[model samples]
Structures are given as C-alpha cells and as structure tokens.
Target chain A: MSYHSAVLSGLGTYLPKQIVTNREVAERLGVSDEWIYKRTGISRRHRAAEGQATSDLAVLAGEAAFVSAGMRHVDAVIVATSTPDHISPATAPEVAARLGCAGAAAFDVGAVCSGFIYGLATATGLISAGIADSVLMIGADTFSTIVDPHDRATAIIFGDGAGAMVLRRGEATEPGALGPFDLGSGGEHSDLAAVRDGGSRHKRSTSPDHEGDYFRMNGREMYSHAVEWMTESSRKVLARTGWSLQDVDHLVAHQANARILATVAQRLGIAPDRCVISIEHTGNTVAASIPLALAHAARAARLRKNDRVLLTAFGAGLTWGSVAMTWPHLDPST
Target chain B: MSTILETATRILVDKFDASAEDVFPDAVLEDLLSDSLDWVEFAVAVGDEVGTRIRDEELTDVRTVADFVAVVEEKVGALK
Candidate 1:
C-alpha cells in the first residue's frame, strides 16, 4: 500500500498514405513556397486517401500502442477527435473492435486541438477513480476532410493523422509518472477560429448561402491567443508540479504551429533545443498533434526513461490545455 | 465562367467522394451528402474560388445544384 501515479507504458502513431506538399498546395492556390513555409513551418502533410476514414487511422495507432505497452487489452479506451468518420456511432467502439478489445468500455471526447490533453485528464481520472486500472487514450483527426482547400491560410495548416498512449496504474512516487493536468478555455474567443457553418448553431440561417460552412480563422487573432493561453497553461502546470522551468528535461508543446511553439518557449525562457517539434512533417494534426509529437520524440530518443516532460495544446473551440509528466521507460514500437 | 451545375456536381463528387450517379444535380443537399460537414467543406471549396462569402444564412435553401449555383451566383453578384 503505497499510492502510485499513472504512467505512460506505450506510444504509437499512424499517418495517412497520401502526402500533400506545400508545393502542391502552392501550385493550386497561387501562393509561394516561401510564404507557406515561412508562415507555418510546414513542408508537407499526410492526408487519408479518399474512402479511408478516421477510425482506420485510429485503429492502427491503437494497435501499435497496445503492442508498445505490452498488453493486448486495457480497462478503457478513449478516442478524441472533431472529425469522426460517422456521426451516429462513436469511433471508440470501432477502434476497440479493430484492437480485439471490443469488451473494453469505449467512448469519444471532443476538445479539438487540446483533445489529447483532455483525453489524458479523463483517462487519468478513470485510473484515480478506480473506474479503470489501465486506459488507452488516443488523439486522431482527419482534419483535411474538413478544410476548405482553396483557403491557403488553413489548407496548409492541417492534415490527417493519429497517435495513442497506454496509461497504466502506477505509484504516484514512481519516477515515470504523470503529474497533475492543467486545463482551461475561453468560449468568448470561440468565434476567432471555427468551422462556422457545420454545427448546430448555424444549422438554420435565414440566408441561402453555404460559405459559412467552411473553417474560418482570424490568423492574427489566433496567433496572439495561442501564445497567451499556451504560456499561461504551461506555467500553471509547472507551478502545480512544483517543478521549475529549468527542471523540465523536455517540453513537448502541442504541434499546433512551429511559430507558436517558438514564441511560447521563448516567453518561458526555455532553450529552443529543449523544445520538441514534429509539425514540419505533420502540419497541424489538430487533436492528434500532442500524441504524434510525443511518439516521434520517444522514437527519436529525445525522451528517455525518468526524463521530465510537459505537454500543451490550443485549438478551434478556443480550447487550450497543458499537462506535466515524466518520461516512462517503454518502447515506442514493438 | 463555369456552369453552376457542372461546378456544384463536380465539387459534390470530388469532396464527398460520391459517384456522379449517386449525386444528381437535383439531389437534396442533406440527402446526397453524408453530413453537414461535407456540404460545408464543399461550399467553402467552391466559394473560395469565386471570392464569394457564402455564409450559413444563405445555405438554408440550397438543396440542388441549381440551388447551390443560384446562391453562389447571388453572392458573387453582391460582391460586384
């Protein structure tokens, strides 16, 4: 009887086969390569081939995570996304089916870009609440399916991908464990970025136009908010963990944008080298960004057992979050 | 200038990955598409080209290619 905190036992990621380069988008939209790369640090992105769905990507990531964790099944499964393949059925059950863990209690969580953070909190809560001994948390998105490709601003910023983590009950005193999570949101700024036309709010507009339906984002406004929220959330999480900024061995901020990540790290006085980035290859995978970045860093050996780490994200619903954890000793690939 | 029918049907087929026969020019927007997100993505793709802002208010009556085209035409005209 000693208390143990939850720890990450495994990691996995899956990217769609179809790769779209900035050059391809530039050719279509009449934009310059310099403009795309300079603005977003995105050189290319992977998109699910037509007919391939979000669940397909999630299942792959989930299976890999299970293998990495050295477990065939978990106590629970949670899928986070804004782009579920089907509206009626939750994608978690489908993911469980593919993992051969159909008996696991599964569901979906929608926090957009901060989704994985939210999923982490929920999964951690389930472990603490005694609802589960082990939980599989996944962040998967087919953001390309929702982007208005003609809009150069957003089109280059998104793609389809997924990443997952296996969380198991462990002693809170363990070196490789998840610290408390910090989360927040500003609903008032919701309009600053959103897919205005699809949700229930605009289901019945008086005018007969369809353009409101695309993702609309005020880039200038979003840029400012992203820095403010992410910095604030990260600082709060550090303080809560009683860990100084210097004590953090690795800062895995969400892969929302390379520029945003740079600004946040600079504001916190953290070395850029210590900051992890995967957006160059993934673009803004939305919900999938955090887990995807973590998976990559773990595979690359940037994250080693007992190393300190921090995760954070901001996205469409004006949602934002951060979490603190120590790097666990687990193979990223089996 | 592209015909409204051709543009709308092409967008529908391409964005939704629906068959040409599955999506007719006169099909209902909701029925022909799987969900509102699909229709919205299609509308955004089309509106981006013509520089027309097709707000949600204007999408209520769009049920067919003729309807979609008419709305786009109206918005494009308004811009003019």
Candidate 2:
C-alpha cells in the first residue's frame, strides 16, 4: 500500500573515439565549418568506427553506469534508441547480456530523440508499480549509420554516443526521486522528421528501388515545434511538480540544437545560466542526448544534491516530454 | 500599413535585425535574411506578435517580403 519512486543512483556516458570535425562533413555538404558552428553550435562530433554497433556503445555505458552505481547488476535493462543493432530482436537483451545482466527484464524503447525521457518515464513506473526494484536505463544511438553524410541539413547535426543511468526504488521524500512528468506526441506532424524507407510501409510499397533509408529532418518546421513543445512540456511538468521557473537549478534539455534549447528556456523564463548546453562538444546524439548531457553536467558539478533539475526533450516521432527531479549526490566520477 | 503587416515587419526589423527599409513589400527575402534559420525564427516571432501560429505550410510560397506579408495578413484575417 505504498508508492515506490525511481531514485537516481548513477550516471555514465560513452562517446566514440573517432571525433569528426565539421570540416570533415562540411566539405561534402558544401558548408563551411564556421557555418556549421554558427548554426548548430557544434565544432565536432564522435562517429562510431566501422565495426562498432549501437549495442556496443550501450554495453560500455551500462558497464560505466554499474561502476558509477557501484553495483554489478539490476532488475531491468531498457535500451532507448532509433538505430538499433537489429530490427527483429530488441537491442536491450543483447545489451543486458553483454553487461552481465542476463536475467534482468530487458527490452528496447523507441521515441527517437525523446527516448531518454520516455525510458525514464517507463523506468519510473516499473519502480512505482513494483515491477522492478532497480533499472538500468540507457539511451544509445549510432545515428551516423542512418544519417546521410552528404545531406547538408542532417549530416553535421548528429553524433554517435551512449549514456546510461542506474535507478533504484526509494521513497518520494528521498533525494533524486523523480517527480511528475509530462510526456506527449504530435502524431499529425510525424512526417516532419523521419526515415522514409525500410519500414513496413516501404516494405509493402510497389516500388522496386530501395532508397531514402537515410534520416531526414525538416529543420525549419522542427525548430518551431521543438521549441514550442519543449517549452510547453517544461511548463507542464514544472507546474505538476509545484516548482516555479526561478526554482529550477538546472535545465538539462535535449541537445537537439543550441538555438532550440535557448528558445525553450527563454519561453519558459528560465535563465540562460540554468540552461545546460553540452552539445558543443558532442553534437546531437539522438536518443542518447539527455543522459549524455546529465552525465556531462554531473561530472562538471553543474548538478548538485537536492537541486531541482528539469529534463525536457523533443525528437523524431514529433514526440516531447519533461521530467522533474531533485538531484542526488553521486560519485564524483559520474 | 495594415496592423498584421506592421507586426510582421516589426518582427523582421526588431527581432531578426532586418533593416526597416529592407523589410518592405517586394523586398527579396534572401536579400534581407540570408540564413535558413532566419525564416523559421522570423515566422515564430511574427506568430508571437499576431497571437496565432504561422504554420510552415503557409510560408512555402514565400519568395519575397510581399508574399510572406500576404500569408501573415491572410492568416490573421482568418482568425478574425
């Protein structure tokens, strides 16, 4: 007859060693490095090596999370991604197996860029409903595999990386307990961002040419939608949590774009200092963005114990969500 | 000038830093605002001023300032 809250325990992140600078893609996309930086606020991004896979990144992050948590296993493993290692079998089980969490309930979640927040909401329920006492939640993606290196719009916008968090059951009064969340989707605008092929729709198509498998984003439309939805979602969650804009200690939003985060923070009346923009070094890591930002912020000490941290993200499915939490003190190595 | 067009022009001038003279009707959009992001930001700012969103579809036919102002004026009119 009690509610269990999913409390934060640890954080870890992994970025591939191969750092791809804007110059690498700009030449192909015919844009200057300064142009890419001026627009996306990215100087470079990490690209997975030829043999590397999404699961590989996830496993490394999961292991790092375990070390951060000082625990070797958990009751559940959830991998959030759009670029999975395989389509038939879910990616989580392999990630769990690779991380020595074989017996833990494992699965994959898809919400594109909002994957981390979506995974957080699901993991919180798993704890609240007593489905799992602890969960290893990971947001990982190899977007480089799906992005067209020559596409001027998307090529320089994405990077490959993974970030994981360990969550454990705790009381609501405990530090790090996640508060209310606002999760939503605008299915009507799904066409605004998508990979137009290789799915059931394309499989059933009569066309013989197998093409358009690359990720495509209408950055123009996406800009307005992302800023509006993320700001709205942030407001909703903050209201549900009974926190004012000024009460927020940090706004760790999806590193989708520097401009988007600034707009959302401005619309919400959150100060620029409170807005944690970690994408300058990593670019947009798709579903892995939030966790990566959190780990980056945590390691930098931007996050502190009992600090009110707001998390919001908008991405591919035209989905958006926000989660409120009081930061928990974790190992300095996080 | 119509209020809607004025709002559009103010956004272009104040928010996007488009020169007041350059935001007039028939002004080439590319000549006024070169960045691709400027169009979307300009639309959102105009939407904020007009109290109704300026959808992306409405901006498709926009090649010149006259064309964009027309769409904004029409959308604002429809709201009334």
Candidate 3:
C-alpha cells in the first residue's frame, strides 16, 4: 500500500516591525559592530513590541499560511517553539483558535532550534497515519521574552519572529513532498544550552533577581555540538533519501550563527554558495528560523520548484534533526 | 612513536593552524588560540586525535598549552 505524503502547500512568516541594529547592541554590550558582525554575521534583527506574546506571533504566521492555502480549517496545528505564552498550556491551541482552526489537533514541539524539523516529522507522521489531511505547522518564538538584554552573548543573537507551512496529504512522488527525517537528541549535553531553573525540576525563587529566569547558553560548547549534530543528522537523512552532498541545492541549516554555519558546511564538503545565509539579517530566531529562511529564499527568488533542499538544525534539549525535500512553488508574497 | 604532547601539538599546528614556534609547555593558550572559543575548538581537535570527547569542565585549569596537553594525555592513556 502507498503511504500518504505531507506535501507543502503554502508558506508564510511574520517578523516584528522594530529592527535592532548591531551598532545599538554594541553600544550596550561594549563591543564593536565589526566585532559582532565578524563573529555572528548579524547586522540587524527584529524585536517584538512590548507585551507581544509568542502565541501572538504564531497566530499571525498561521493566519498568513491559512489564508494563502485558502483553508478555513485544518486537521492539525503543530507549533514548534521554546517560548510559550504561558507555562501551563501549550501555545498551539490558542494559535489554532485565533487562526480559525479551532478544532485542529493542536500541540507544541519543544525542541528549540530543531523544533521546525520535529514539527515537520510530526505533521508528516499524522498525514501518513491517516490522522490528519492537512497540518498547519508553525515555528514561532519571541526569545526576547526570556533572554537577558544585558547579557552580551545572547542579546546580540536572538530575534523575534514566526514562520509557518500548510502541509496537505498527497502522493509520495510529489515535488513538494517531504522525504525521510533524522531526529536525535543528547540529554547529556542539555546543560550546554539551558535556563537551569524555573521548570518543575527547579522551584522558582521568590527573589526578583533570580538568574534562572533568563536564557543562558554555553556558546563554546553550543558551537561545537551544533556543528557536530547538524552535520551528522544531515548525512544520515541524506543517506536514507539516497542523496549526495552534491545533490543539495540549498543547505538550510539552522541560522544559529555565521561561524557555526560556515563550520558545518565546511565539514560536509558543501560549497559556501549552496547554503542559505538568512542569519545575516534576522540573527537566530530559535525555532522560527528555518521556515523564515525558506520564506526569505522564496521571496528573493533564490528557491525554485523541485530544487533539492536539505534542512538541518540543532538546539536546546540538545536536539537535532534533518529533512531532505525538493523546493515548493511559494507565492511571491511569501 | 609520537608522545601525547607531540601528537597534541601536531594537531594544534595542523588542524587548527597554530604557529609551531609559539606552542610550548609554558605558552599561554589564549595567546596561541586567540580566544575562549578557540580554546573549545582546540579541545575538540585534541579530542578527535585522542579518540575521546573532552568535557568543558576537563579544561578548567587549562590556561597553558601544557595544561591542555595534560588533559589530552590523560584521555589518551584511558584509551589504552
């Protein structure tokens, strides 16, 4: 029997209006713009307005995708995010309700930067299992909500944004059909990128000055692990799909940082021109980055129909994943 | 046979582009590798050569080239 395939139908993204330049960040962090640029390759990034929640960004991106796909309802709404509107409830239901998909099977994927790939896997599994005909998979985050602004390492990197895709059931041979996925996690390295407290395992301190409330990353360790896993996962998925490094038209790895991207590409023996360098402007938007990069490529006319695209990401939860697929025909507005 | 120090120093020179002359037992690693990020990369390079992954905490006292080499030697000895 032929299995159902999750084919890409529509794509959309929402980046906050306010742009923060590296010069501004440099003034606060006591570093030169040239220093930050040479290291992170971020010139500027978007910042959400005060009081904007992660669910709000998700809703906007989901609505754009729903409108573009011309769907009034969907079978599932899977949001991939590290930051949620509330600690108690998942963010997907509120996003689904707001996007006029009130009854979809809604939940959140908490794999951080690798979240979009995980969401894709979840969506594809749902369609393959006949549990859903269509899925609105969103990768959204407002990392500014949790990052400490005064902290130089994180403040210069994270931005606020959301991106989404509408996936419909189709045949496996379709051009937009997603291929086999490789997902892996290393809990042993979880502390490399962690909040360290405020979760169930650690009680919330009564003091307002608690360090656990802010996101903290071990940049050195993160740099090494992300490169290691993203490259390895990409190779695994490519082998499963029977594609070579030369077959990859676009290497859309997680837009974590310029250096990490360069290192992974070098390790894979993939040419620099084959990579999608969306992190230059948006910084690292956490889970929202991969889809946002897709939209950026599509909008710039860099992505084309049936082009072999390789997606890989690694992030907190020590999670990493990769997906191999051909490019979809996205609308110009994407 | 190459000793652990010679193997580690060779990795620093070949894989990570460290100047061979600047590498010594008392040389400061920060000066040789440029920054803390480089320190981590150096650990990874040494770990790859040593056949084991180096933990970040394992290099806590590694300000000098000899200190990093000591860690690499320890990992190499364990591999036997």
Candidate 4:
C-alpha cells in the first residue's frame, strides 16, 4: 500500500476579544505587574466571553482553516483540548457539524498542552493509512472556566483560545509536509499538573472541597520535566529528520511559559532569535499554544515559506511531543 | 577544596550564576533560587556532579546550602 504525506495546507487561530492585562491580574492576585511578567513572560491574555465554550472556539478556528485552505470540505476532524463543551459527547463531532462537514469522522484528542501535535500525528496517520484524504485538526481550550481565580499560580498563566490547521494528502517532498514525530508520556508524574476532580476517580460531587475542581500544577517539577522531556524529544525528531539544531529556522514550541521556552531553546542550542513566542500576549492557551504561535508567527512574517520549523510541547499528563516541518505559504486571510 | 561543600557550591555557581561569596553555607536555597525550576536544575546539577541521584523528597528538609551539601555527602558516602 502506498502512503501519502499529510501536508499542512492552511492555518488559523481565534483569540477571544476579552483581554486581561498583567496589571489587572496582579491587582487581583496582590502581586506587582513586573513580578508577573518576570515570572511568566505574559503581559496579557484573552478570556472567552460568557456563553462561549471550547466547541465554539474550535468551530470558528476550523472554519478559518477551511477558508485558508480554500476548501469547503474535509474527511475528518480532530479537536485537541482538555476543556470540552460537554463531557459526554466529544467536541470534535459538534465542531465538524458546525463547520458543515457533518458525518465526517470526528473525535477529540486529549493530551493537554501537547494536544495539537498529538492531533497532527493522528491526522497524519489517518491520511497516510488511506482512512481519510484530508483532515481538519483543531486545538481549543477555555481553561479560565476551570481555573480558580484565587490561585495566583494558575489564574495568571492560563488564557482561552483556539487554533486550527487543514491537512491534505500530499507529497513528502512538499515544503509543508510534516517530517517524523517523537511523542512520550509519563503517567507517574500525572499529578504534577492536573485537575483533581470532575473525573471518574474523583467525581466533582464526591469532593466537598471545590478547590479540587480547579487546575493545580507543581510548577517547579513541571518546569524541570518540561525542559528535559522537550529537549530530549526535540533532539529525537531532529535526528529522525537528519536536521541539526542549527538547521531549525523557527523553534515553535508550546507557549507554556516564556522562561521554559528560553530554557528549552538554550538546552537545544537553538538561539533566542530562532524561537517563536506568542505567549506574552496570549498567555498559556494550553492545547492551542503551538498553532496559535504558528499563526501569529506567520502573520508577523517571522515564519516564511520553506523555513525549517521545529515544534514541541509538554503539558499535563506529563505528555510531551515534537514534530518537524518546513513552513508553507499560507493565505493571509487565514 | 574537593570536599562535598566546596563541590556543591561550585555546581550552584555554575548552574545558577550564583556568586561564590553569596553561596555561603548559611545561604538559603529558596533565597538563592527564584523559582522551582531553578531548584530543580540545581538539584540535577548537584546530582550529576556528585554521582548520586537526588530525589525531590530528600530536598524537602534541605533549607540552607549546608543542608544540601550534607544530603549530597550522605548520598555520595552511600555509593562508596
């Protein structure tokens, strides 16, 4: 059987209109604005308006991706997110239906911040295996809904947004064709970042303490593990693609934090100029981080066609992954 | 100069850009390191230098540079 390459044909991102500045968060958390910026490298972030859900953001991003690809249809849709509109039915099916691609194979991929790359890997497989010729992949999250406003650690770091990409069956020689991927998980460290309640193990009602409903993260442990795992995984993908750190024109890492991005790039020997960061304005949009960063990079002209881009992410569930691809020209409207 | 204290101090200076004078035996690790990432990296560097695995739980009681030095010394001694 012949395998086809899954080429990233288009990209789009949607950030909610409500902006929350560091000053506002600092005043609420009783910290100086400079302290927040110095620690998280975030100046502002967007919050979804009331009545907005993960699926709403996903649908908008998916539509933009379709428009960017100049195609009206896709064979499958994958939504990568930790926050879904409903816990029962997956958000992808609703996202696909809303985008008018009803009945298309649609599902959700949950890997927290690493969701986008995992979704990309899944979409690539679907296309290569001849299960689908084209795929619409989206990473969306509304983390602010679950974040405890009183917790300075999480409230300041998380924002809500969505990003989507259109992938089509194409040739491996194409500039946008994705190269090899490296993915890994450490379940033992799952507690390093998670929401303790709302899941089967600890149902929301079972715990009287509402604090368990909010997201919690061991920031220090997460930082060390993130840098180590991302660096290791990035090196693996680069080796798989026969590309060196010097060959990467843009290191589009998950915008978890600016400090983490800098450390990972430093460890990988990738220069600061080669790193792509949109987190300063977007905050940590969880699963939406990478694609949103990519879209922002394209809009800023920092990412050009045929440039070698290295993508990596580490998030809750102790999940991390990396993918390499040469940037492709995208529609400006996307 | 090759004692565990001196070696640990050297690792801290190299890994965290701490001044040799500031990294005294009494200096608190929390004061010297701003965030958890710094502490984690410091622990890893110390472990690598001393040829011992430093567990996170072991660092709970470690406050000052002397405390960290003692932990490293204990682990290295166990390896011997």
Candidate 5:
C-alpha cells in the first residue's frame, strides 16, 4: 500500500509580550472598541518586544519543538514567513544556527498566512521523496514591523508571533500522520491584499503617492475573496482526505479574524466547538497563526491523540491551502 | 452575597460560557474554565460594572476566586 511518510512529532509556539488593546487603538483612530470587536472579534493583539526580530521568536519555537521531539537535529528546516530578518540570506539558516541545528538544509518560504501548511507540504515531500529523513517547520513573522503605526486599519489587525512543528518520517498508519496537501493560489487578486510599497514593483512604479506604498489593502475586496477561497480550499482538502465536517474533530485555521472563521465554519457546517479560535488575543499573525493555534489547542486540552484535525489558511499572494491529519500521541514537553 | 459576586459571576458566565458559580471568590483566573481572552473580557466587564479597571498585571499573583474578591474589595475601597 502507498504510505504517507511524515508525522507531527512535536509542536511549539511563541508570541511577543506587548499587547495593543482595541481601546488603545480606538484612542488613536476614529474607531471604537465595539466597532473593532463587532467587525473582527479581536479585543487585543501581541506585538513583538522592542529589538525582538522574527528570527528570535522562530528560534524559541524551534527549540521548544526540538526539545519536545527529544532530538537535537533534523534533516531540514523550512521557515515560512513574509517578514524575513533580511533581504539576502534565508532566515531559516540563522534560525537553525541559533537552535544549534546548523547542518540541516535551511531555506525560507514566502507564502504568507498559508505558509505553515505550505512549509508542512514541503517538509513532507522532502521526507516522502527521501530527500530528508525529518524536517523542522517554523512559521514566524513580525507583522507589526511592516505595519504603519498611523494606519489604524492594518495596525490593529496584525501581530508578531511564531509557531513550529517537528515532522519526522513515519508510517501512514501512525495516528499523527499527515495526508496529502490541498493547495491553491490566485495571483489575480494579489492586489486585494499586499504591501503596496517596498517591493520591486512599487520601487519601479512612478506613483507619486509614495507613502501609500506601505501595506495598503482593499479590505472589503480582500474579505470576500478570502472567504470564497478558504471555503473552497477546506472542502477540497476534506474531500481529498475522504473526511467530512463530522469527521473533523478540530478545525485549526489561521487566526485571521472571527467573522471569516465563523463564516467558513458555518458554510462547512462544522460545529463552533470543534474549532480552535485564538485570534482574539493574537490578532492575525500571518504564517504563525495555524501552528500557534494548534499549540494553544494542545495546551488547552482541546486536542487529544488520534483526533482528526483540519488546518486551513489563506493570505497574500492570494495563496491558500488545507491539510488533514490525525493528532499524534506524544509528550509535548518531551 | 450583596450582589457583588453575583454581578461578577453574571459577566464571567456570559463572556466565558462558564457556570455563574465558577466565578466564585476562590476561582483562579488561569485555572478557571476559561481562556486568556475570556479573562481579559471579564476584567473589562468588571471595570464597566465597578467603574474601575483591573489590569492583568494586578492579578498576576491571584490564583483563586478569593484573590479576585480581594481585587474587587480593593477596587471598592478605592472607589469609596
């Protein structure tokens, strides 16, 4: 029989210490706590402490995952993020070096929120193809660094955090084994959500409103597209795994917003209790959201061994993906 | 129970989906049948009800319902 070769051996997460509450944001802009909560269901979000880079959080989560897995080494490291520490060298190499796992092939994936899932698929493929015996997938982002403090729309919605998972070669029969990934992208709607300035496109563009270049987005258009794409992606992944809404014990989605998650869950007919909803506190941590939510779920006792979990995410690049896997049985503090 | 605990319990129950009694004097913030967001919301709700805010750091050493009661008592005293 054909076999799946990667299993989630451990999980870990890290978020910055500072919290910017809705009330604080309200004081700066023409918005209220009620307005923000009614729309996004977010009351507060964590920001990275000063001088804390994306790599700092990634290293913390990677160390936690490695300790949990009881291993000091892995065959590869994939850091999924939109905000890398620098523009040239891959952030994964630095993260690996900090975690003391320097020999592994380290690289970065820039899929934004759907990054962890994409990273997982990359790691799984590596293991399945015998390119790597095991892989460390770290999703970290300091979204606050790129966000314009004066722009209320984006400032209140993005946070800084990291999450990680240790995936090792294992049998498909293992309970924590991951199924094939269901991934999709729509570059056509890329402008709906993107950092307008700072990229090569903006650098080359002759637009005089240069300051408008910082993370500008069409929120309304982005919302509609995100909901549609996420719904479709979730359905496709469930069907590919031969699992239905009732079969999924937990829905660990990217912590984008409460309304989007609720709409997707409602459309899928997945019970509200079956989902890990942690965005209210962390806001949208982009690539870090999924694994961060999963780590929180395990800590909260909401996730148990052998339970079927569904993870889905949609973000910039208009990239989106979903994965179905059985929760692996292991000591998180191993 | 001069409605202080009862009022607190109502807010906790509505925000946390926990039983009213779960917000008792000895209830631990982290150990309660609630999540981190629930506690933050609860603190805000208590602020609205008592006309005073309870910061997260203020409850760092508080682990049970009595600790929260002490906080409420202090708020009451400060208001008085």
Candidate 6:
C-alpha cells in the first residue's frame, strides 16, 4: 500500500506585542548591551502580554496558517510547546477549539526546541496513515513565563512566539513535501537545559525559595551538544534525502544562537548566506524557532519555489532533529 | 616527556588563547578555560590528537592539566 506524502501548504507566525530590548535586560542584569549581543546575537525579544498564554499565540498562528492556505478546516491539531497553560488538558485541544477546529484530534509534543520537527513528523505520520487528510502543526512557547528575571544568561536568549504550518496529503514528488527525517535524544544530558520544577520529578513549591521553577541552562555545555547534534542531524537528513550539501538552497536551523548556526553551517559546508536566521530580532523562541525563521525567509522572498530547504533543531530533553523539503509558493505574511 | 602531555598542553594553550608558559601542568582547567564549552573543546582537541574520547563524567575529578593528561595516557595505554 502506498502512503500519502505530507506537503506544507501554508505557514504563519505570531510574536507577542511586548518587546523587551537587550538594553533593558542588560540594565537589570548589570551587563553591557554589547556584552549581551556578543554572547547571544539577540537584540530584542517579545514577551507575552499579561493575559496571553501559549494557546492564545497558537490560535492566532493557526488561524493565520488556515488563511494562508485558504482553508477553513483541518482534521487534526498538534501543538509543540515546552510551556503549556496547565499540566493537564494539553494545549492543542484548547488552541484547536479556539481556532474553530472543535472536535478535531489535537495533542501536544514536548521536544522543547525540537518540538516543531517532532510535531511535523507526527503530523506527517497521521496523514500517511490515513488518520488525517490535513493537520495544523503549531510550535508555540512562552519561555518568558519560565525564565528567571534575574538570570541574564537565559533572559537575553529567550522570547515568546508561535509559528504554524498547514500540511495536506499529497504526492511524494510534489514541492513542499517533507523528506526523510533524522531525529534523536540524549536523555543522560537532559539537565544541560531544563526547568527543574513543576514536573513529576520536582513538584512546584510554595516556599519562598522556589527558584527551581525557572528555566536554567548551562550555556557552554548547551553550545557543545547543540552544535554536535544539530550538525549530525542535518547531515543525516541530507544524506537520507539524497541531497548533497552544495545542493541545499536554504538551511533553516533553530535560532538557538548565531555562533551555533555558524558552527553547524561551517561543519556542513553550507555557505553563511544560505542559512536563514531571524534570531537577531526574535531571540531563541525555542520550538517556534524553525517555522518562524522559515516564514521570515519566505516573507523576505529569500525562499523560492523548489528551493531545497534543510531544517534542524536542538533543545531541552537533549532532543534534536532534521527535515528536508522543497520550498513551496505561499504568502508567508498570511 | 609524554607526547600526549605535550599535545594536551598545546590544546590547552590554544583553547585558552594563552601562551604555553601560562598553561602549566598544574594549572586548573576551570581557571584557564572561560566556560564549559572551552573545557569540552579542549578535551575534544586532545582526543583528536591522541585518538581517545573523553566522557563528561571522566572530567569530573580532573582539575589540572596533569589530571587530564593522566586520563588520556590511561586511555591511550588501554588502546594498546
């Protein structure tokens, strides 16, 4: 039996209205703006409004994706997020419901920065297995909700945003059809990037010293592992797709940092200009990084139809993944 | 002199962006390296030169260049 191919039909993204400049964070942390920029390559990031949650962003992005695709309905919804509205009742259902996708199959994927790729794989599988003809995959995270305000290391690196893609069943040979995937995780090094509390291992504390609830990252270790895993995964996917490095037209890597992207691109022999980067303004939106970068590139007309695109990401849980695709025609602004 | 030690010292100097004289055998690795990335890169560079891999756990008790050299020597010896 032949399986259907999942092709990306539309893309959309939503960044919160509250912008936090590096200078503002630097002032509070007693660091120079240049110091923060030199370290993370981030100038500013968005923080969710007081009442805005991850689902709120997801709904907006999902609706925009539907509008871009010129479709009113999808069969399933998959939200990739590290920060959910609550521990129970996954954010996908609420996001789907709000997008008028009520009664559609919905759930959440938890691969942190790599959540979008994982969600893409899950959505593709659903389409291939005939479970869904179309799926709305949203990568949304309000990392600002979990980061410590006093910790400059993380404060300078994260932002809240959401990006969505509409995938429909199509033929394998068509443009926008996802290629083979290379996915992996290193459970042993999970602590390299994580939130220590509000989980089964460590419950939320009412005590005044409940600092563990905030996100923590060992930058040096994270850099090493991120570069290693993302580079390896990108190579694996390129190899699986039977495309050489030189044949890649665009490389969209997770907006973890400028240094990591440069290292990965150098290792893969991908030219600097060929890599899509939006982190300078958006910061590291975690799971939203890949799609947001892709949409940004598309909006700028940097992406063209049939361009060979390679996507990769590394995140908490030590998760990493890569996927290859041909750029499709779409109005990214929608 | 052990070639592994010489190679390890060279890697340390390069990683720390310091001179050979500054990267003494007794120098603390954490003190010389700016961050964990430097430490990991140093280990990787040493492993590349000596044909050995350094696990993160192995570096836990290693404080000085001599400690890292000893670990490398042990791994190199085990390869023989």
- lDDT for each residue of candidate 5 in A1-334, tens digit (9 for 90 to 100): 4445799998878887788899988778777898778767889988888889999999988988888888878989999998898877889999988888888899999999899999998998988988888899999999888787778668768888898889998998798798767988989878767776666665543567555446765554455556667777889988888887899999888888786787567657899999899988889999999987887788788889999999899888889998889998765531
Provide the TM-score for each candidate, comma-separated.
0.78, 0.94, 0.90, 0.92, 0.78, 0.89
Candidate 2, what DockQ? 0.56
Q: Give the alpha carbon lDDT tens digit for every residue of A1-334 in model 1.
A: 3444677888888998789998999998898877788778899999998888889999888888988988889989999998988766889988887888879999999989899999998888888777889989989999888788898768978989999999999877675577778889889878887776655776644356556766778765576667768888999999998999899888888887787887678767789989999999889998889888888888888988788898888886788889888887877752
Docking class of 1: incorrect
* lDDT string, candidate 6, A74-150, tens digits: 99999999999999989999998888889999999999999999999999999999999999999999998999989
Name model 3 segments beyond 4 Å from true.
A332-334, B1-25, B42-61, B66-80
Among all windows of 10 consecutive residues in model 3 chain A, the one with the lowest summed lDDT is A325-334
| Candidates ranked, most accurate by TM-score first | 2, 4, 3, 6, 1, 5
Cα lDDT of model 5 by residue, B1-80, tens digit = 44567777776677567776556776666766444434544665676577675655576676776677678779888888
- Model 4, first chain, TM-score of 0.98
Residue A180's C-alpha lDDT in candidate 5?
60
Worst 10-residue lDDT window for candidate 1 chain B reads B35-44
Q: What share of the true interface contacts does each candidate keep?
A: 0.00, 0.50, 0.43, 0.43, 0.00, 0.36
**Candidate 3 overall lDDT versus native:** 0.87
Compared to the true structure, candidate 3 yields what TM-score? Answer: 0.90
- How does each model score on lDDT? 0.82, 0.88, 0.87, 0.89, 0.80, 0.88
Q: Over the stretch A119-180, how does candidate 3's per-residue lDDT look in tens digits?
A: 99999999999999999999999998888888987999999999999999998778889978
Better of 1 and 4 by TM-score: 4
- Who wins the lDDT comparison? 4
Put down candidate 2 lDDT per residue, B4-74, tens digits, no spaces. 66777777787777889777888888787757777777777777767777766678879988898788778
Instruction: Quote the B-chain TM-score, candidate 3.
Output: 0.81
The list of candidate 6 runs beyond 4 A from truth reads: B1-35, B40-80
Q: What docking class should model 3 receive?
A: acceptable
Clash list (residue pairs), candidate 4: none
Q: Considering DockQ, which of the candidate structures 1 and 6 is the better prediction for this target?
A: 6
